[model samples]
Target chain A: MRIFVHTTYNHRDYLKRLYAKIVDVLKDSGVMVITNHDHEGKEDLTKSEIERMSDAGENVLDKMDGIIIEASVQDSEVGYLLAYAIAQKKPILYLYEKHSGAKSVMGYFTNSKIPDSVKIQVYEEPDLPAILSDFLHRIETGESKDLPTIKFTLRITPQIERFLKLKAKQYRTTKADYLRDKVIKKYMEGDEK
Target chain B: MAKSRSKIALLFFGGSGIQTGDGRIFEVTKKEEITAWLKELPELGILADIEPVFVFGGPASEVTPALWSALAKKIGELYPSVDGVVVTHGIDTIVYTGAMLSFMLHNLGKPVVLTTSPLAKEMQSPADSEGLVSDYRNLGVRANLINALQVATMNLGEVVIMHGNRVMRANQTIKSIGPGQNFFEPIGEGLLGKVDFGIKLFGHVRERGKGKLKVDAALDDHVCTMRIQPASHAEQIARMIASGCRALMLRSYSTLPYPQSFIPYLRLAQEKGIPVVCHNLFALKSTRANEEYILINDMTYEAALTKCMWVLGKTREREEFRKLLYRDVAGERIKANV
Candidate 1:
């Protein structure tokens, strides 16, 4: 699978470490990562060169299956890039360093609306590659959680129960199926309760 | 003495819980099904003459300013014939729609209740356990909708959320955050009423308008929001402004001293005649008046974002924009010296 990895220029050392570790992980694997360690292009690059580099970044993002961004660095440009990635509905994994005292990058999505494809993880050094590889494996195997499920207990009277059973018999289905259909019917019913 | 029944209009837009079964498979939802469910209960008829209008169906993310404008228009056209209104919407954007409706209505003489079910579940007869039968099979989604409909019949003269037995003022309502919280909460003054056995309205009920109904459907669509974090780049703000971000909801974790680096960007946005409102999330302490040039006021985070979108829908003029922002259209803002 082809994936894009984005990081701020501030995380050059972290990106280098990630690149080295990932190359080892992907030795025989089919995963291809397009990451530009030189996030901030050459200082003397011409306007056309800069535009071309920006276009190249966007093009890589366009073809990639997903994105992995180093959220540890607090760069607004990383945020801008993430916004574009999200608009594309590509699965995103937000990786941040385990920190103390300083604010966690995880705070970004606390109150913000999050898409189901977005995942955030905090990591310490040695397990970074392992965790990233594991996330990718699960992503490929469709093992990651897709949606959150909620459970609740309901209370209904005997009459409603009998009514449901009778309706189920009338509809030639089990009571559970009948109840589910009724519930669906409720939402379909005009707009009221 | 018997109370006269109300002619209530229930407008349906889509929300999460009702659209899915335990947030999974998309369960079939239709207007007639909802009516059949309601008709099963005899108590509902005693409350009011229920009129359900299936406007649209989608998740909360599908809610747009245009949908809100159309809703305002629908309510205006129907208010003369109906006693009150109830809206079933997605939990994520319920507060936004509620706040928008509050401003759009300006001065609603009758109640406009917005309610959402955070969990929609299916019940079985419990494997030969008719022994454990009672009122234990009611889902929050159904119960919350009934409560909302009941509140709508009461003519509360405000947009509100009726969850379980609690009646929350719409503009003042904030989505509940933190652990184990799923419903929207009323900030500051707390809940407006309770339906323990009967409707118990508390204080803070405003003096409502007595005359004609007014609907402000002229909403500008060029508004957007950006959060100011510890490392939020000013360049992003500059780009947003350049891209015709007519209004901006500049938000922070709290109303602490805003970063000085943001000042130049703020000035640039202002120079382009775009107004900015700094919204404080989960505000505890009072905001300092450092950024006086930018209108800073207290509002439920949901209300601030929705109100920004609502205000933009009408006018982006500097004077009218600020007036709409600061003004408490249907008690959405705190009475501050902004």
Candidate 2:
């Protein structure tokens, strides 16, 4: 799964370490982590590229399966991106460095109004890996309810049923699972609105 | 406690910068679609109550004097209703549009912000893909738009271009040549503001509610612009004059003893009663104004060129055109030394 990680440019030493640790944990778990900082042979994007996609009406968050933001340093850009990701309804994990003296704006997401897709956690450096792993695990296992849960019944013609069976067999999965994972998920992710 | 939001009229002239996901630029053809689109980004709603005003749908390069006139008139019409105006344009000709509007919109009391998104370069390899997603989170159209909306609501009033962190005067803007963080820069003390932790305005800015809005969108597009080269010839000027060119703007060497071969062409333009403007020519010492050509030292090439079109549109008589050209119609030029 693809994940986008964001952090502030402030508090360079602490935040940079926190960012690197998060990337390492995510990478170890086989998650494709996208970040603006250059690391692991990946160069940061030029200003022009960012502007181009933005101009093209493309949001980078749309491509990600999930988002992780380090909110120990409050920043306007971080806040904006968080709001954008939340609006996009992507599963988000907000990490706040414990006792950093900076508050996570996510505190405003009270229980009543907070969407199930958003999770807030405070972490000491040592507990960060576990917190991130649990979040990613929940997302992957659908325990976080990121995947479609409600059941729906549909009638299918014989020709369509044959096509579904063939595609499911080729992919080595049950027809229901194949249709849900490939067709439905793809459609949902690629939907323009 | 909640405060009232500023009502910003977003004059949408379709540019590649503000295009939507359906491969279509943001055009206010349907009110419902525009409303839904705005609802998708609630951040803009938090910043201001944006009313989308459709002007045109095309690349910035296609923007013409007529479009500039229309935009100025639209701003004038909306000035009484909205707190400020944000114009979405293509990055290619956004500076020119900004420059023209700075002149066309007269006695502006509210901010007129022009913004555009840069087009991305083609990715070379698989590794380049990460940059695309990561960069979007940091800087993109959304960040620029947010900053621009905030600038639109600011106390300052003037025509400015917002890109990245820089807020520069429209006429004084020059498109940066190489790969740099900033796409545009101001000329001659032209930076109106910068967006960092918050918007910070430099001292030289027109405050909001200072004057009533008026538009002088008159423009003559028959002006010819030429850059002097070592091998430049006079025949080029003759052809331009023959093709109904009313005014000439020359990008000359910074330090000039102008090439001797171009003297007759200067004389020719003078004899033909065509007004000539020499741009980027720095005087070594105090020099008397040459009747043959008007010298522009401090203005950007885009501003000087657009100003010529504007001045020509206002008048055709040689002396009158010269007078209007140097009149500082907007803050496009530095004050002349007495």
Candidate 3:
């Protein structure tokens, strides 16, 4: 099973343990670690490596079966990456390091109004591996993807359709294309889902 | 009466916002204290001509089976006269009251709104505190009362909890825990509707039955509830089996079976023909374990517990018991997969 793990790029010291912990947790699972960072303490990854990581991350996520995100440190790029994963319909399991005010941020990923909002869980360092293992198993067993995507048509006003057309043309995109992009971007940015 | 005017039955049980001689230093009969409190809210008459009927006094936890029965009877008797009924209850066990009424009252096509507040500073403190000085208008809690009354008038036609500025089906909502924050959250979905400007309905309101309202005050409160934990004591369950009640709502961990020790007691209960409903676990479909022994509590714990009381009043027959558990009574159960 291929699983993509995303974390904050801003925190070099934090990822020192986070990367190692994730590696330790996912050790025996045989799931491919997309973000294979050489976290030998604070020199987390090179500047060129970080640049290379984004494209690699996107590519890995494309081929991966599931995603495990460490949201101990909030980052905008991480949010966008998580949102991108949701837009792709990839089942995700978000991990939050147990902190006093963890519940506040945990709800965004867990109890999201977003249709693809993943299961957000709180864990101490020791429980990370077990939680990841259970999450991966759920993905393997199709428990995480309990509800399959279904297509349906929604009737809208001519004016609304015209507005969409105008906006889509202005944005140099199709109405259908822009709608999905705008909604996903808005949902990920916490503007609306 | 104006075209918009609604005859709302305001049944007061001395919850927050109602002085009930608690927010002030005085002594009076329960009925008089409630009536006096109503007189203080003369402006409330502008919203809806609320016919204040005093049910009980004290915190919501003081509500008993007799009280619920009496309140149910009152709502039934007044159902014909009023456009709807707004129940003023304490927040402590308000959801339980809501669940009880959802089962106890049938064919209720009028809104049965339950509303309450945190024990406001005025209600908690005496004359010495600064709260009493500012609480002359009952603070904004009385405004919340009027909001509930307004909701009762909206033809909502459902048992709803009007708290945290949102109205949700009584049977589907559970009380959120926090200080001065008692929000009723719907089990699976979002709120039924928001109680904000213009009374926007969320289209979640169920269609009312096309028949006369039926009242079944026969609730067997002998039913009790227990949440299953990793180290659950089977002896306590055995003791409960020996003498506690006729039925039990066992809140399981993910609707799974109890510990091995609890199996014998559960088997014993099953043997004695008692209905031990394992509740509060979400099960859109029955699993193998569910079929073998465990009963999935697909409904909110509050609803499941109250439904147990309601069902126990009907029958102990295994077939009937199973039927009612899975039945869509008041839209409580999550829709089973087709």
C-alpha lDDT (0 to 100) for residue B68 of candidate 1:
89
Candidates sorted by TM-score, descending order?
A: 2, 3, 1
Best by DockQ: 2
Candidate 3: tens digits of C-alpha lDDT, residues B27-75 = 1226766556555544355455567687776766678877888989999
The C-alpha lDDT values of all candidates are 0.61, 0.71, 0.63
Fnat values, candidates in order = 0.00, 0.03, 0.00
**Per-residue lDDT value at A90 in model 1:** 57
Per-prediction DockQ, in order? 0.01, 0.05, 0.01
Candidate 3 Cα errors over 4 Å, as ranges: A1-193, B1-4, B18-29, B120-139, B178-182, B207-210, B283-294, B336-338
CA displacement after TM-score superposition, residue A142 of candidate 2 (Å): 15
Candidate 3 displacement at residue B211 in angstroms: 3.7
Clashing pairs in 2: A55-B17
Query: Which lDDT tens digits does candidate 1 get at residues A1-193?
Result: 7666665455367555664565445433567665645433223234574354332211224445667776565443344344434434456777766751123333333224455566767777787667677767756765544421334466889998898888775543457655554555445643653
C-alpha lDDT of residue B171 in model 3: 84
C-alpha RMSD of each candidate structure in angstroms: 25.3, 11.5, 24.7
Candidate 2 interface CA RMSD, Å: 9.6
Cα deviation of A177, candidate 3, in Å? 48
* Interface residue Cα RMSD of candidate 1 after superposition: 24.9
